[model samples]
Target: MGTTQLESVPEPKYWHLKTVLTEALDSEFSVGEILPNERDLAARFGVARATLRQALEQLELEGRLQRRRGVGTTVAPPRMGVSVGTEQHVWPGGPGDAWQSVDCTEAAPPAAVADILETGRDEPVHTVRRTRMSHGQPVAAELLYVPASSVPDLSAIDAPAGAAHARALLRELHRLELEGQDSAVELGSARADDAKELDRLPGAPVLVVTTRYVAGARTAALSVATYRADTCRLTFGDSGGVEIHHPHRHAS
Candidate 1:
């Protein structure tokens, strides 16, 4: 006779709570119906506030819940499908671009951006800040980089500097033949500055979209954007459409 051993598996509490909350949302809660306060929910679940919040945050990110600062957490509608890979080789501000310019400054970009731009570490590049909105809610933040050489005609004495210069830089980019563009998306935590612009808490889950604009033999511009992954579903279609995804938590 032989004895067999069965090993027990461990699961995180927050993950478990997310599953339970998801079921409750499906069967018990209606869209826009406010849930119990965090303290009450935590007490009901016999977990710490942080743990309860972790589950709620995940649900919010999956577009299953929405949380307001003074208001309360409620069931959220389906996520919005924002285009990503539809027309690959075009400037962002061309059409159907929801981004609005904030301001522009000539400063050294982050080291990672400088590497992609292939510019000298100390060289000043035009950094244009922009924000994207959807359904009247702030959804994304972006930084566009353009080197001095890319737009030689952009004068040191441009009529206006901030957003005007930013728009001018984008307009000049149109003059150059867009040879190609490269972009990627990855999971990331929001930085403090971006969090403020995106109206999210610091270290919130985000989808970082990095793009490089190519002209002739040089990198004309680079765009680094952070999107609210919980509310946005990156889509790429000539005719944009919406789709809903329900994420399930299951054991391996």
Candidate 2:
């Protein structure tokens, strides 16, 4: 265990703790390395356990640490980046897409999802859970809802159904000229189920991307994708390599 007395700064103790811990994580830790127990860490930092825990919580939320029951906290690997864009819209199984369906079942859409799908509150929709991995890391988990009417030929799908079947259904459905798509991104916390899939604790910070696909004049499908935020920078529009200018800074 390494020890260095952190100088007392005017900032809040928790903030300072977070900074010191972050630097330590960057310099002395590798992904999946177990951190020293909180008691030892506090003793080394000369701070209270509560302060150390607060910093740890923030780091966990940012996908930097994993805290498991009976196991100590460990450093987390980088998150994956999944692009959300308006390019050629194709079926889920198309080449180059990073999503793979995990399971599919019939369920009533959540109230919010029902509203967006423009279906009755009790209407049953095919819910497909998909996990997207990039660079060998799990990045996003999605719940895709497809109305029965949109996929009338689902009976032909094979048993032991999963990504392959979901892909087939999507390919057939895409015959209906997907004309356009609209999307919205917002900050959200990972729900219990999603947290389990993403290997993080519940209420972890995430970027929720909701997309609606239109065929003709009607909404055909809806996809809600939750992405790990700390390791992603959601890019939009053309990939113009322009440098962003900061108005607050002036050249000396």
Candidate 3:
């Protein structure tokens, strides 16, 4: 008989380590429980430190692990169930909204925002920036574009362009009857500024959520929110759940 040879397809060592650690997490680890230091874990796994870290990073992206700058890595609880949609459309700052406005400025929006707002690219808007915190950790950063015409009563006289000004813009928006709102979500990389707010390195994976608010058939406002892809689960309906199978996927 002719000799038969089979090619070996070895999975990457890091992938094996990630799978083992994941099983350990399910069977042995508890949420918020700290894992052993990296050096020890690497030695125990018979892998290099860098290989071990690669596994940990993927685990963190799955929301199965949490690592802080100074604190060691620990098991992360389930990602927060951030309600992005419901049977009834709700405006930002509506009841139970998690966003906490930080500041506002009247400025021209970027090209993307201007396009959706159907306004002149150079036209000014109330750029309200807000942050979303979950379980005491910042999980998302949002930039809301409110056209000046949408809030005619909002004047330069309305509190200086700071936290109060931001709040006022949202308050004015709520007064108008919101006819409808639409949204889309996609994978993206965090910009440098957004990365800072989300406590991640630049180019970190993020879930970009774009929304448009309509009033009386005109687009009144737009929102571009970036959620930490590793730690946030945006729930629009039955689609809410931790991303398990593709946990290793990252933004290009």
| Model 3 residue 164 CA deviation in Å | 1.9
Counting clashing residue pairs in each candidate, in order, gives 0, 0, 0
> Per-residue lDDT tens digits of candidate 1, residues 60-101?
878788786777897775576766666667885777677898
Minimal lDDT window, size 10, model 2: 242-251
List, residue by residue over 117-226, the lDDT tens digit for candidate 3: 88899998889999998777899999999998899998854487788888888888998999998888899999999999999999989999888999989999999999
127: Cα error in model 2, Å: 1.6
Q: Give the runs in model 2 whose Cα sits over 4 Å from its true position.
A: 1-9, 69-71, 85-88, 133-138, 159-164, 230-232, 238-252
Stretches of candidate 1 exceeding 4 Å from the true structure:
1-17, 23-33, 38-54, 156-159, 236-242, 245-252
Ranking by lDDT: 3, 1, 2
Top lDDT hit: 3
- Return the TM-score for each candidate structure: 0.78, 0.76, 0.86
Q: Is candidate 1 or candidate 3 better by lDDT?
A: 3
lDDT of 1: 0.82
Instruction: Give the per-residue lDDT of model 2 (tens digit) for 162-203.
Output: 766676677767767777887889999999988888766798
TM accuracy, model 3: 0.86
